[model samples]
Target: MLGLWIAVIALVGPFAAKLADVQHDKVTDYLPASADSTQVAKIEEKLPGGETTEMVLVYHRDGGLSAVDWETAAGQVAEITRQHELIGGAPKGIPSKDGTTLMYPVASNEPGANEEQRDKLVNDVREVAQGEGGLSVDVGGTGALATDSGAVYDSLGGPLLYTTVAVVAVLLILIYRSPVLWLVPLVVAGIADYMSMGVAYGLNQAFGTTVSGQSSGVMTILVFGAGTDYALLLVSRYREELRRIERPYEAMVAALRGCGPAVLASSGTVAAGLLCLLAADLNSSRGMGPLGTIGVLCALIAMLTLLPAILVLVGRRVFWPLVPAFGSTPKQRRSLFSAMGSSAGRRPLTVLASGAVLLGALALGSLNLPGPLKQEDSFVNKPEAVVAMETLAKAYPGRGSQPIDVITPQGRADETLAAVLGTPGVDSAEKGRTGDGWTEISVFAKSAPQSAGETATIKSLRDELKGSYVGGDSAQQIDLEVTNARDTKIVVPLVLVSVMLILIGLLRSLVAPLLLVVAVVAVWGASLGIGGLVFEPLVGLKGTDPGLGLLSFVFLVALGVDYGIFLMHRMREESLAGAEPATAALTALRTTGGVIASAGLVLAATFAVLTNMGLVQLVQLGFVIAVGVLLDTFLVRTYLVTSASVALGRKVWWPGVLSREPGPAEPAGSSGPAEPPRQPESLRAP
Candidate 1:
């Protein structure tokens, strides 16, 4: 098995290394294909220069701009015009009303659709447009912002991987306490991550799947987080089995057979939830579905196959200091989980009510969440492009800083230009390029980019100009927000229904599935509510990412349910063994509680690493998922779910065989059979 894995890794390693090469962070890549902005972007790429690279140069002084500063700005603009193939003509300076800032709009077609060349153009312009001691000069526009954002995205690969690995390694060490034992799962998870990357890259190539920085980064997180979770569950079960079975190989097989159903069900739920993203209208959301599934499935395969192979090969000694001696029973003591279960059993209603109220309170914070994030505010730290945009916003408060692109058929170009110029909020309109039966018109609004007035203007243009498409950075942002809202309404329900069905199939009980779904949904709401409180006030984030709610819900529900599965599956096993409902509930909690807690810590910690990322969206996402997982682990799964089960007793599995009273033939404390009875068909591992 080891040799087979080694060969597979060698074959896929090159493809994995090349995954970064195909990733794209273009504005259109994230927009829905059916959106007007997306249509405009596609048509523009087929125009004279393929795609125009637009930028704005802002030269400003604290007090006021002098003649020299004006001259310097003009000279730099002239230099830029001479060095590159500009689209319109030499840019004319547009001074601020207060005379504190002078701006020149620059556009070039030389770089076209090549991101590398476009980045070089922006950098070259920045080098030439330097500011002196009293003057501040910055390049701000869609092109420059894309370059800066792409740089951040590109840098995420190595650092994000290293940081995730380091975080998971530390957690594993603490959880295992055995110095060498932690290395086995950690190594296997890393291998799983590499395998996932290869598979993701293949999906991109074979099916032309969209590979964005956000999707790829999320894929890496799932590979490590979900992979480690599977490892923790399997290892914990292996340790328990080792005490009973003599041969190391036989013990490993028994362990797999014992815990395999729960592990498979857990991963299956996550994959199904993620795949629901395919129904979303947004491109980025849709792309994340398959990539995320690839990560989870890869991790599942590695943990089940390669991990067991290695543990068996290394023999029982692999456990080292805390090795479980064959035929020896573990020490008996009152553990923390036992105490927790006892408390819940004593006052089930009180515990359940308190947890519900706490979650409800946390969910109220969602009302405080800020508005949708603007492009300039997406970064955690202010980049050059963001600084320029901020300066422009303050300097030119009466007009938009970004251009609004209007694409129309060449035959109707004159009519469309006239209609755009007559729009209510339009400041100016000019015809630029005409090719491939399409004509491009650049329109500027009287309000700031992504502002309410600008959005209204874009909508008005779309309403009036039936054949023309209005698009640009601001329009794209509008499209993205609308698409995200639409996706949320569609995808959320699909995720809920899909996940609920999976749970029902696994547990074979309607009530059990409903309970798990409700718990996870509560976790999602509370997590987002926490984000609303922290994002604007505590973290100083200006706005929330549009897709934050939907993505976080999917993750928290899918990932959070894993613990519930681990706990409830064990409860079902005990009940099947003829134990009373209450006894089975407490027993399951006692046996699986510690492992679930460890697994939760590892999953939450892996996501928390994203908080250190450069993007505000990533930070918000990381915070919400990490907090949600912790809440699920310590509160919902441990206390509320357990209490509810103890309170409900047999009805928790309503309509199932376990829900009924045991027959007279089956004694209360009698062992049902010498060997455990086979699991029901629905309960068997896939």
Candidate 2:
């Protein structure tokens, strides 16, 4: 197995480093597939020089722009046009009503659809449009915003990977408390991540799945988080087996025999849940499903196969100062979970009721979450584009600085242009390039872009102009909001149903799966609620990402149930081995609680690394999922589920065979000296 993994790593490892090179950060890559904005983007790419880069160079002063500012703006605009291949003629400057600002509309196809080239163009323009003294120069438009967003996405590659690895390494070192033990899982996880990247890139190439910075970044997180989780469960069990069995190979086989089913079930549930994302309308979300599933599956295969092989080869001494000596028993002590079990056992109903109420209260915070995030507010730090947009919002007031693209049939170009001009809120309309049976027309709204009035105008144009598609950054945002609503209605139930079915199959009971599903759903709501409380008030974020709720719900429900599976599976093992239901619950908690807690912390911390990313969406998704995992790990799995099982006793198993027949219980009047309480049969090495 070691030789096999070494060969696999050698062959596939290089692909991981290449994932970032193919990752696309285009706006259309994330948009809904059938939305007007998507169509517009597709058509734009087919045009003469491909998509045009449209931006505004704004020159301003506190009091009023001097004559020199106008000349500077004109000269810079002329220089930009001379250097680049602009679709339209050299742009003319428009003076603000207050006479304090001069804006020049610039359009160029030099950069075309290449995001890097487009950003370079924007940066070059900014360099030439620089302002000093009393003058202020800012570049604002859809092209500039795209450039800024690309920069943020580009930053995700190295920093996110490094941070996640560092975080996982630290957590593993702390959990294992051994220099050698920490390196094994971390290295294995890295290999799994590399394998996942190769598969993801292949998926993207063959299936044309959208490979965005967000999706790929998420894929890496899942690999590390889920991979380490499986490692934790296996290593913990392996440690226990080493004490019983003399040979490392036999011990590993036994360890896999014990924890393998639960790990498989857990990773399977997560993968199945994520695969439900394929039903989503949004391209990015849909693509994430496959990529995330790949990560989990790869991680699962590695941890189950390569991890065990390597650990077996390393032998028990790899545990260093705390080696599990052969034939030795684990030290007995009062554990934290033992205390928690006592409280839970004393008053299960009270504990369950209080937890439910607390969750309910936390769920209320969802009401306070900000509205859909605007393009200008999508970053944690204001990018140049966001800053430019903000400057335009203040200086231009009622005027929109960005153009609304209307793609019309070439035969109806003039008629479409007339209709666009006739739209209620249109400030201006002009003919653009024509190609492939279609013509592009630029429409400017009287209101600021993405404002209520501009949105109304877009709606009006779409309604009035038959065979025309209205799209721009503002229109894209509107489409994103609408499409996300539609996708939520379709995807949410599918996710719930899929996860429930997986749980039912794994647990082989109706009630337990339902209980887990309900618990995770509550965690999702509470996590979002927590985000609502902190995002705006504490983090100073203006709005939530449009897809945050849906993505978070899917992740929380799927990944959150992982620890539940670990706990319940152990309990089921105990119940099947003749332990009474209450005893099984308590024993499972005592044996598995610490491992589950450590796994949860590692998973949560890996996700929390996303919070440090530049994009607000990544941060929001990370925060909510991290919070949900922690909540599920510490409160729901440790306390609530255990309490409920104890409270319900045999009924926790329900229609399963273990629940139907009476478990092995102490007989009355059996007063002989008790043998050392028999260990659960499942825990013994086969």
lDDT of each: 0.89, 0.86
Instruction: State the RMSD for candidate 1.
Output: 2.6
Clashes of each: 0, 0
Which residue pairs come into collision in candidate 1?
none
lDDT of 2 by residue, 1-686 (tens): 88888888787777766777788988788999999999999999888778888888878898998888888888888888878777667888888788888888888876345776788889888888888888888898888888888888888989999999999999999999998999999999998988999888777778888889999999999999999989988898898888889999998888898888888889988998899899999999998999999999999999999999889888988899899999798778888888898888888999999999999999999999998899888999997777778877888898988999999999999888887888799999899888899999998899997889998999998899877898988999999999899989988999889888888888878778888888999999999999989999998999889999899988999899898888888888776655677888888888888898899999999999999999899999999999999999889887889888888887766776655754245321123433344454233211
Highest-scoring model, lDDT? 1
Pairs of residues at least 3 apart in sequence or in different chains that clash in candidate 2 = none
Report the lDDT tens digits of candidate 1 across residue range 317-429. Answer: 88888899988977888888889999988899999999999999999999999999989889998899999999999999868889999999999999999999998999999
Q: In candidate 1, what residue range of length 10 has the lowest lDDT sum?
A: 677-686
Off by over 4 Å in 1: 111-113, 667-686
RMSD of each: 2.6, 3.1
lDDT of 1: 0.89
Query: Global CA lDDT of candidate 2, please?
Result: 0.86
